[model samples]
Target: MRAAKGAKGFKIIGTDGLPGPAGGIEAVAKGGWAGTFTYPTGAKEAIEMSKKILLDCATSVEPTVTVGTTAITAENAKQLMGK
Candidate 1:
């Protein structure tokens, strides 16, 4: 596995790079957090509304969306994801 520059001890080789004879390793993108959800319906709508709320709030106060590469890291992993 190849590690990304400035990632410290983290190795993010990803799915594209496995040994020639991949030992039963199937790399697939697992569906993760896509924002809040509601039973029956309105999951996407809820997320949109939440974004709007966040945008409105950010107009007055600084706001951060912890998405993409910025969200996942070794330091905050345990705290955000738990044990």
Candidate 2:
């Protein structure tokens, strides 16, 4: 867990919400759009943000493929599954 391993905070570059429930498998809190930033206040803002980001960067073409290239290391893997 980066947070537990002395990471104050981190940035995720080039990310998009996952296609299903598996998206939140590693989240610390529950709410908002899957894999999108959820403000403690609500999910609307996060959903809007996701929509804008998706619209601007990627097209929603059916049969689209998401190349799963996210890297995982021993140091970070635990953080994902939780303590």
Q: How many pairs of residues collide in model 1?
A: 0
- Provide the clashing-pair count of each candidate structure: 0, 0
Candidate 2: C-alpha lDDT:
0.38
All candidates: TM-score:
0.21, 0.20
Runs in model 2 deviating more than 4 A are 1-64, 67-69
- Which candidate number has the best lDDT? 2
Off by over 4 Å in 1: 1-10, 13-42, 46-70
lDDT per residue (tens digit) for residues 1-83 in model 2: 34543543553321332333454323322322123321133355556656766876645433433333433332343355442
Instruction: Choose the strongest candidate by TM-score.
Output: 1
